[model samples]
Target: MPAPHLLLVEDEPRMAAFLLAGLEEEGYRVRWVDRGLPALEAVGREPFDAVLLDVRLPDLDGVEVCRRLRLHHPALPILMLTALDAVEDRVRGLRSGADDYLPKPFAFEELLARVEALLRRARTAPALSELTDEPLRLDLTARTCTVGGRPLDLTPREFDLLAYFLARPGQVLSRDEIHRDVWGHDFDRGTNLIDVYVGYVRRKLQEAGCPDRLQTVRGLGYRYVPVSASLHDDTA
Candidate 1:
């Protein structure tokens, strides 16, 4: 297979240099751009496998660049890099059509893992089937999720999280297990990344008028209790 082509858009010289060297070392074809316009132009000229976009750019907001890229290349995998780790910031990136979000000051291992997962999903998307937990259904192929037959708008990460839960009904999943399985990363004790995403999915499910399928098991992790059947939330 050919090397994955990646476009890196960052304004900071040192950061760009660091990422450029690391990505190159990992045997990826990376194109560096200092501004948003150039990044867009570059993508138009070449077929890139993925894009590493910074949220703050000199010429344009990285989120807007992502939105534009999504409009033209809906299937293109985009990972947004930013210093902000707020829930809204992450949601904004995903809403702009980013396949993944990695905050700045992250380990290169995590970035590489995210990029790989996005690429893997892209390559295997056509072979995926819809996952369902009764009223909640996730069309993995279309990347669309619905609850109770009503379409629910989900961020890429949120959809993946819910799909993971639906795929393993009644199984108590630890935080570390969820992180490793869902996003190809080990659980970080210092970060609440897993919790934040779980909260998002739970809230969305509730908003869709679904039951409290996700239950906190005191000292243990969580489990998906399907509503269609009499699945007990027996996690402890």
Candidate 2:
């Protein structure tokens, strides 16, 4: 496989140079952009495997850029870089559509590890095929989902989560498994990110007039029951 293409969006000259050199040395194809608008344009013009976005940008806030990027490429993995380490700041980044959050002053190795993890997950994800469960259909190649023949506007993470569950219909997945498979990270029992994303998927599925096929297994993580299957005891 070719080296993963990465987009580096950081305004600080010194920091950008450091990241660009380090990432290139690590065998990644790196494109460095200093401002938000240029970064947006670059992504629109080319395909990138992942993005390292700094929160402080010259033209637009990184979070805003992240949101816009999500609209354009809902499946692209985005790792947010920020000087602020507060929980709220991290939450803001994730809420804005970033797939992962890394505070600044972080070690280069950690950043590379995160990027590699994202790439691994992206590569290993189920092949691009139309996955269907009767009324619910997920077009993996197009990255579009429809429920009852009506499209659902799902966020990137939401789409991934739903796809993950739909791929393994009727299997009871643990939170740890879901975290590792969907988020490409070890599960942190303390964090509620998985549950939040699951809820997001559930809400969209509900809004699309699909049955709450996302069944909660009490202590177990969750399961997806195909609409064709019997739902005698499945809990939404």
Candidate 3:
């Protein structure tokens, strides 16, 4: 499949370079515009899956550009980025019809996740009631997990961590990805809470006789490996 294309509007050269490199590494096709007017022009000329708009711009303001863009393309996903942490700034961006907001100094993983989420919502689908990989069944609504019909008693955090891995079976989940999505915040260098939780979940899977094991990738993160081809994933 072709990668999703993105438009980035930021006046700072260093910040733009940082985002472009990181996003491109993740397989996105990105076009960089240093000003807001060019951003509007670019969107009018080409289709993009999403836009990462910075609050302050060289010519036109990002919020005004967002408002105008929304009028022109109502369905397009716009993710506003700003160093301003004020609630008013966020509210103004939302009022301008941005699809989401991310304050500056964000983890690249978090930014990537938000972009993915925007695309996901744009192409909305039926919600999954369960995430299953063979003998391991994670009930989405009931919030229960079972291995071979025997339930494994788990803490709320443990359950969420397992569910996360189950959703993306066989995918290499970065430490930051797990920390941000499962724990609902940025990955803190000062803490090893994610490691601690992952350990707990991994041990439970082992004890429950689950064929899929959460294997740490040493310096990277974890990948859940299905022991057999028949052990497949399904959102039922």
Candidate 4:
């Protein structure tokens, strides 16, 4: 197979040079762009396997660029680069359509690993028909959700969380498991990001009139009750 092509959008000349050298050394064909507009133009005119998008760009913020990119290439892998390590920043990047995120001052090896993982996922992602449970439906290929045939608008992270739950219907999933499966990593026990996202998904589900299928397990974690099952009776 040909070497994977990557588009790097970084305004900092030194950082861009460093990444270009590192990625090229790993056998990736790299195209470097310093501004969001040119980056978008480059992608429009060329085929790239993935994009390394800096969160702060010269012409436009990476979040806006990512959002626009998603409108045209929903399945493309976008790895966001940012100096800010705040959880909210990461969440914003993900919601804006980034496939993965790496805070700045990161190890080159770690960046390479993330880029490789994104490429692997993009190439091997499974295709499935709509996953249905009565009034709720999750179309994995289309990346859409609906309840009782009414569309549910969900952020990218919310959609991912729901998809993870639906994939393991009736199984009690610990917060650690959900974190690993959906976010591709583990978080501290004190972190409530998982709960926050679950709340988001739950509210959207309720708004869609899908009932409270996501049940809290008190001491354990949470379980997804399919529409066909009684939410209270299922103990998994």
Where does candidate 3 clash, by residue pair?
none
**Number of the top TM-score candidate:** 2
How would you encode candidate 4's per-residue C-alpha lDDT over 1-236 as one tens digit per residue?
A: 99999999999999999999989998999999999989989988898999999999877789878876764566779999999999999998997779999998999989999999999998998534467787888786567888888899998878878877886788999987776556542356677999999999998888778787898998889998886677456542
Cα error of candidate 4 at position 23, Å:
0.7
Following a full C-alpha superposition, what root-mean-square deviation does model 1 have from the true structure? 11.2
Specify the poorest-scoring 10-residue window by lDDT in model 3.
227-236
How much lDDT does candidate 4 score? 0.85
lDDT tens string, model 3, 1-236?
78999999999999999999999999999999999889989988898989999999878778888866764455789999999979999998997779899998999999999999999998794546687787888886577889989998899768878877876667888877676456533347578888898888878888888754787887889987765543464521
The reply for model 3, stretches above 4 Å from the true place, is: 125-236
Task: Give candidate 4 misplaced runs (Cα > 4 Å).
Answer: 126-236
Q: Which of 1 and 4 is the better model by TM-score?
A: 4
In candidate 3 the C-alpha lDDT for residue 177 amounts to 69
Q: Candidate 1: global Cα-lDDT? A: 0.82
Q: What local lDDT does model 1 show for residue 12?
A: 98
Candidate 2 lDDT over residue span 172-214, tens digit each: 9999777655654234768998888888888877777877787
List candidate 2 segments past 4 Å from native.
Answer: 127-236
Residue pairs with clashing backbones, model 2 = none
lDDT of 1 by residue, 1-236 (tens): 99999999999999999999999999999999999999989988888989999999988788888876764465788999999999999997897679899997999899889999988988987633677776878886577887778999899878777877777787888986676556542247678898888899888888888776886665778888787545543441
Worst 10 residues of 1 by lDDT: 227-236
lDDT values, one for every candidate? 0.82, 0.84, 0.83, 0.85
Clashing residue pair totals per candidate (backbone < 3 A): 0, 0, 0, 0
- Highest lDDT: give the candidate number: 4
